[model samples]
Target chain A: MGRIEERFTALKKEGRKTFVAYLTAGDPDLETTARLIPALEAAGVDIIEIGVPFSDPTADGPVIQAASQRALKRGATLAKILAMTASLRRTSGIPIVLFGYYNPILSYGPEKFAGEAAASGVDGILVVDLPPEEADELRCYTDPAGLAFITLIAPTTDPVRARKILRRATGFVYYISVTGVTGTAAPRADDVRSDVERLKRMTALPVAVGFGISTPGQAAAIAPLSDGIVVGSALVRLIGEKGTSDDLVPAATSFAGEIRRAIDAACPSQGKK
Target chain B: MIRTQPDRRGHFGIFGGRYAAETLMPALLELETAYRAARRDASFKKEFSFYLHEYAGRETPLYEARRLTETLGGAKIYLKREDMNHTGSHKINNTLGQVLLARRMGKKKVIAETGAGQHGVATATAAALFGMECRIFMGEEDIRRQAHNVFRMKILGAEVTPVDAGTATLKDAMNEAMRDWVSSVRDTFYVIGTTAGPHPYPVMVRDFQSVIGREARRQILKKEGRLPDLLIACVGGGSNALGLFYPFLADPAVAMTGVEAAGKGLDTALHAASITAGRVGVLHGNKTYLLQDEHGQVRDAYAIAAGLDYPGVGPEHAWLHATGRARYVSVTDEEAVEAFVALSRQEGITPALESAHAVAWAMKTAPAMAKDKIAIINLSGRGDKDAETIAESREEKE
Candidate 1:
């Protein structure tokens, strides 16, 4: 099994819900990102998502968008991010997922991206703009390269369409809790709960709910419904607020810990029969 | 050489496809089905043609530029005056068809993205005609540059929403429009201004705008006794050029050229010449040549014309360029400005700065061709909306 699968499986055995933390790869700078990863892991993050910043992050809202711009301004390319991931692998065993848009991978050539990303200790990949219908090219290489090609399902995904998207989905399904872009408005927990319940009945793969789940209270509310909880814009917003200072990591770590504690407290028992 | 229709999956030779968020796939597929059905329905065609003639003003004049032709002292030049249409641009051709499609699909609201406000004005105009609620997304910079058009869209009953993300240009406006569409998928229809974006949009917009080529073909044959030797149009997202080139694709003898906005020069970072200088990448839901950095982040594109200052072109244009069916060239801001002034003085026509890119190319190329050869330029819009910018540019020069 891949790192993403192994981590989730281990978490299931431990009777715990996973807390996935996201940070832009070169947000204030790559070194700062490298520093934040271990802090995030130490703060109880089960899995780590490294956002490869792009010029046009349409799906993202203001917070992540600004973070991406900061990362890009630091000259963060796919190669640089991959190299940074390789460096991060020396001391940390946390499963690293590269989240980004499709153009960068396409520009890097799918085969090259897959090979390099896998070699860099990256465990999974998610391209926001590339839905299942157009994901074949990237998947063809990623699957063979031992990188889990993650899939996303939104509130708008009907049962029939959800089934089709999840048919070959590996790792986990990212259920976008909201209908709009990331970071705009918080999603209703009741709506997300129903959607997660519907998805759980259809597939054996874990479903992680994300997008618009900001505060620890919201994370606690969503934790009972899914295998994992991905918190992105909220953490990125803190980083944007704090900037590239010495205080950045501690604040982010504290926030992650709060969400992690909330998730662990809410879902005390997790291993399924 | 004649096979140009997109495949069932909407791949225009690996360039165009339905690259969208999972939330949008169903809507896109539904739109594809509706558009395909509408295309085959005779009444749909009849009504569409009726609006084109009676409302948007079809068959806009194909005038021979006698003064320009005489000044060039070479090839005879003709202008397919799409600028004469209501709303002052070729944008209405696609907007009218889309609003009609939205109505048929039982949608009550329409949304559009604009660069220079021509498409916004045209979409607002159509929404007003159909009595539907309209919202137009424009880049913050464009909203400021084309302030008059923002007022025009407001006057036409559209909510002009200024998008401030990602360079605040056409690409960001498209991103905002897509986000809005996803938010309200059931009741809203996204009328993409250009022949770009995801599948069905490129094909549908092309079909709607192909009337330009069809009429030009007939008009040229009737007046000149033959097809023009060359066809030229400015390509931002490539709607107007594709419109004027689609019907004539089968004619192996007639050459086609698309002029890109070279703001400073191709050598500099300040140009919108995607095919000329950019690498193959995806943006706005389609794989096309994009002005992107090595990291695949879309770079800032610049041009004197707000309409042409976009980072990517339509996927069909990517296919056409790759296959060598058409040639893509670049003209600098100075050249386009010179053409804008020349057309105003020489032909008593003030062409939009976007259209001036093509006029610039035509003026340069037509003078070198034989006197008997005919060259046609798709004058995609008028310069009335650009009067302020033009005046500002003149003051800057002085």
Candidate 2:
């Protein structure tokens, strides 16, 4: 099994919900990103989603959009990010997912990207704009490379289409908790709970809720309902604020630790079925 | 045989598809189903035609530009007078059709993205007729440049939201509109203004705007008793060009040219000539030629005409270019300005800056052709909205 599947299996057996932390790969620069990854792992982040910056981030709100601009201006490219991921694999075993738009991968050539990304210890990819109807071009290559093609399920997704989407999904499903762009609006826990329950009944694969998830309180409220929860804009916002400061890594690490504690507190392992 | 394009899934070869986020997927599917049904329903057709004829003033004339022809001293020139439409452009044709669709789908709110604010005004006009709430997203830079059309949109009861991100142009405005649609997909209908965006949109917009070509075909037959040898139109998001070109795809004798905006020059970084100077990539949910860097990041496109200043063209244009069915060329800002002035002086008609690109190309190509050869230029809009920009340019030159 790939690292994403293995990590989920371990977390399920341990009766602990997975905590996925997202950071733009070259926010201030790739060096800061490389340093933050290990620090986040030490602070109990189960998965790290490295955001590859793009010129236009339609699905993201201002925070992540600004983060993308900063990263792009600093000369971030997919090849360099893959190289960084390969280097980080020399020491760390934490599951890593490259999260961004599809154009960069297309520009880099999909066949080559899948091979390089998988060989670089990247476990999965989540392209924000590439829906199931448009995923085949990349999936045909990524599947053979053993890189999980993570699918996103939104609040607007009906059950029929959800099943259609799940048929090709490999890594844990990312459920966008709200109908809006990332980092905007707060999703109510009650609404997410029902959707999560419905998705759970459909697929045995884990469903990790994301989008509009920020506060530890929000993560705690969403923890027990699914296999995992993804924290993106909040951590990205924090990084944007402290990206130039000396305390950037520590601040991000502490933030991840806080979210981890919150999830554990809300859904303790001993109470698992 | 040539007309059978964009298979059921909306791919024109490898160009157009639904590349939107998952949140918008179900909505896109729903829209596709509705649009397909509407295409078959005669009543939907009747209502759309009713609005186009009675409200938007359809059957706009195809006038022989005798002065322009005589001045050029070569090919006979005809202008498909889309500027004579009620909203002073061809945009109303698509907006009227889409607003009717919105009403049929029970959508109470309509949102759109505009560059020169022409589409925004057109959408707002349709929304007012249907009593639906309307909103428009325009680039901050374009909002300033095209303030006249922005005010016109406001007068038509649409909220104008200025997008400040990513060079603050048409692409950024589209990004903002998509974000809004994601949040409000339940009750809102996103009326994409051009022949771009995801699936059904390109096909739907093309179908609605094809009225221009249909009318021109009939009018030309009546006037000249023969089809024009060449068709030319300016391409921004390429709606007008596609509208004029789709009907003539089966006519082997007819030739077509799409004029892109070459801002400063083609060699410079500032230009919107996507097909002329672009790579195949995806942006705004369609795989087409995009003005992007080697690393796949889209670059800002520049043009004196706000309407033509987009980084990407419609997917159908990309297909046409790929198949060599239509020729794509570019006109620089200086050349377009010259055409804009010449047409006003020669024909007493002030063409929109966007349409001036086509006029400029016609000026270059018409003079070299035989006097008996006929050419038709799609005069997509009027220059009333561009008076300020034109004045500013003249002042700078003086």
Candidate 3:
């Protein structure tokens, strides 16, 4: 286990929830993306998920979909993502998880992908489409290389299902906050709160909440209940509006700082990792 | 011994894997477990046989084509009339079994990808029979070439999604089907229309399609009092050929020939000749003989029959060719067109352009042999869709 798993374990023990942020690498440009990493770390995000753009992303929302389209237009690929990961690893040793669809990896082959990903300083991989059952087939090939395979648990999951997922889950569990599509934000936080509590009772695995979670108000509200609040589309929207690739460091730093403050205010005890 | 590949994933000597999106993991597990149980159950096999015989119009004639044999001027030619099947193609044989398997596994939707649209039609037919929702993904180019199939599919209540990427043909359509499978794996069963894809698919499809060879064995023995000297079928993705060859594989007396499409002759990207000129590579799911660049990325390919326009031959074909039990050959699109014209006018049966490749080879090879040398060819599909193209090509020649 890397910093991603280790710190999350400690936080779960100390009764603190974790907050993770997702960003597409080289969405607008490589140089600007080069700046966003440490800003996220400084912003009090427990874990970082870097989106590896695939041409066919079947499960992505409109914002992530748009981010992927932009990245592909700028000629993004597995090789390009590895380069970004290599660069980002220099200063920040925060747990970096890669969230990608499985086709690109299939095209790349399993052995080669595992080797490349491990060498590139990636701690874990959460392929949205690859669930625990399929990951079991790949575990022999990827696990030897020390790459943690994280599983996603949906709201539709029952207790037996959650336990099955928890047993197979390697890193923290990513609980999809709602039932429908990825981008559509929640209308009510009550169902989400109850679901989180249910999940908390079920597994010892650190639970990170994502999908349609945007505003800091949402993050602050979600922070008390869940171990991590994963804010993607909103931060992406900000990056699309206010940031440029040439200087994404300042953009990410500022955006992450705001989320960090919100999280800190909600929890208060856990400050300065 | 049924060639037990128990421990291995999909290596009939190096092929097959779970090369798909991760979301499909849970669903594929469900199917794999169900298939394992289903294959072992006598009731499943009994039901499959019952469906094959009564519903699919199986036991299709293995007729002695006296006219074609006389015209070729040599050994006799027997035709395995798969065209007489319910949907006018051998594609239905596999689809029927797969749909039943899906239904047994409690899935509601059966999705498929097609190029010439035969598989789509067959899948739609099966889905309708099983009362399952059907979604067929077809290449945009194919939708134009085989427009009637599109309308038929619509009437059959199948949602046809046109795929337009990477040459806009069968391969792209397959990619789209897989993308759909990723999300809908919960209630959807992907009826992979051929003896291709991952381990269990190739294994299961081959078993389903092997009915052709099984029937041919009994029919040939009943008619000729002995085994045929040779067997042949065109090899697009090699399903129909595998169907015929698999039953007679251990019969050393029978020589098998799998013909590949030599679209405009075998010059790099201009052909679909897999075993003849292809290097080992992976596509769809299984690693086999593929027409790939140095980067191993699949290259564009051509074929007269839209059905045979694929760059990679199925992994099982590669295995058969390597083991020397199956001899592989190539027939150019021109030669196939000529054979298509010859067979139609003489035998009065229009053959699919894909199947015509095998027919053309039999026309050539059957003539070179001495009298009494028996040969059989699988007329894998009906050729009504080719009438327009055949007429246009003839008009140009005139």
Candidate 4:
């Protein structure tokens, strides 16, 4: 099994849901981002999504966009992000997923990127712009390298198309909770719950809900509906606020801990002892 | 001569495809299917043609430019007057066709992104004609510069939203429109203004605007008793150029050229010459030549014309350039302006600044050709919408 599947299996056995934390690599700087990964894990994140900064992130909202600009200002190239991933592999076993747009991977050449990304210990990848139809080339390299190529299903996806996408999806399906770009808008929990249930009936792979879950209460409300919950813009916003603070790690850790507590509390029967 | 159909996966050589969010895939597929069916239906074609001829005023005149031709004293010059079409630009041609298709698909709302407001005004006019709700997303900067067109859009019953991201230009407006389409895909039709974007869009816009080339082909044969020696048009997202060039791709004797907006000299960073000065990159769905930085961020493109201020060209143009099927060149703002004034005085025509780029290239090249040769310029739009900007620019110069 891939690292993502193994991690989900472990979480299932523990009777707890996975919490995926997303942070832009080199937000303030690459060193701080490297430190933040272990800190996020210690605070109870199950998987870490490293965002490779791009110039134009069409799928991103203001907070993550600003973070990307800051990261780019600090010279965060894909090679540098891979190097940082290799450095982090020296200490951490948390599932690492690289998240970003498609242009950089195209510019980097898919074959070279997949090989280098695998050697750097990246467990998976999620490109927001690459739908399943355009993902074959990337998958040819990623599947052989044993890296999970994660797929996304949005609220707008109809059943027939969703089935087509799920047929080729690996690791897990990321269900975008809202119809808009990434931000802190409140998602309709009941709608998300029904959508997750419908998607669960389609695939054996775990389903993770993301995009717009901001507060601890919001995460708690979404915990029982899916196998995993991803919190991105919220954490990126905190990093932006405390960018110069020595307590940046502590601040992020505490926020993640609050989310974990809420998830455990919301699903007491599935709580890890 | 190369056949120009995209592959099943929507690639033209190494350009064009549905490189969009997974959320948009279903809608894009649906659009493709609907377009295929619409194209094959006789009644649909009849209605589209009727609207083109009646509503958008098709068969725009092919006027011989006696005065300008006399001044140049080399080749005979002709103007394919797309500028005479209703709504004052070739933009109305694509907008009317897309809106008619939208209505056929049972969509009640349409959304579009505009750079200089020509496309916005054209889309708004079509929406008003069809009684559909229209919303146009324009960059804050574009709305400010083209304030008169913004008012025209509002007067025509379309809502205009100002985008405030990235460079606050065409790219950002497109980003905002795509975001809206994803959010409201079930009920909204995205009427892209140019021959860019993913599959079906590049094909659809090209087919809709090819009326220009189809008519010009017949008219030139009728007027000159032979084919023109050269064909020229200015390219922003390349709809007008593709419209004028698609039919003649196989005609080897007819040399074709596309002019890019060189805001300043190409040696500087201020031009929008994507084909001449850019590398291959993906933006706004299709893989094409993009003005981007080393880190793959799309850079802001500048030009005297807001319509030409975009960093990427259509995928078909990229394919044509790569395969040497068509020559791509650039003209600076000063040269285009000089051509703009020269055309106004010499031929009693004030062409859009975007079209003037083509006029500038033609002025430079046509004068050097043999006197027996003929060159036709696709006058893509009239200059009424640009009067204020031109006046302000001349004032600044003074």
TM-score of each: 0.98, 0.99, 0.80, 0.97
Q: Which numbered prediction scores highest in TM-score against the true structure?
A: 2
- Compared with the true structure, what per-residue lDDT tens digits does model 1 show for residues A1-273? 888888988888888888888888888889899899999999999899999998777788878889998988888889999999999998899999999999988988899999998999999998999988789989999999989888999887889999998898998899999888887888898898889999999999988989888899999999888898999999999998888888999999999999988888888674444
Ranking by DockQ: 2, 1, 4, 3
Output the lDDT of residue A3, model 2. Answer: 85
Model 1 per-residue lDDT tens digits across residues B206-244? 999999999999999999999999999999899999999
CAPRI class of candidate 4? medium
Which ten contiguous residues of candidate 1 chain B have the minimum total lDDT?
Answer: B1-10
Candidate number achieving the greatest lDDT relative to the actual structure: 2
Instruction: Return whichever of 2 and 3 wins on TM-score.
Output: 2
Question: What is the overall TM-score of model 4 with all chains considered together?
Answer: 0.97
Worst lDDT window (10 residues) for model 4 chain B?
A: B1-10
- Report how closely model 2 matches the true complex, as a DockQ value: 0.90
- List of clashing residue pairs for candidate 2: none
lDDT digits (tens) for residues B278-352 of candidate 3: 877656666678776543446666787888878887777888887777899999988999989888888888888
Candidate 1 displacement at residue B65 in angstroms? 1.1
Summarize candidate 2's per-residue lDDT along B1-398 as a digit string, tens digits. Answer: 44788988899999988789999999999999999999999999999999899888888989899999998998999999999998899999999999999999999999999999889999999999989999999999999999989999999999999999988999999999999999999999999999999999999999999999999999999998998899999999999999999999999899999999999999999999999999999999899999999999999999999999999999999999999999999999999999999999999999999999999999999999999999999999999999999999889889
Tens-digit per-residue lDDT, A83-171, candidate 3:
88887888778888888766556566778888888888888898775555346545667788888887787765666777777876777
Chain A TM-score, cand. 3 = 0.91
Per-candidate Cα RMSD to the true structure, in Å, reads: 1.5, 1.0, 4.8, 1.7
Instruction: Score residue B37 of candidate 2 by CA lDDT.
Output: 97
TM-score (chain A only) for the predictions, listed in order: 0.97, 0.98, 0.91, 0.98
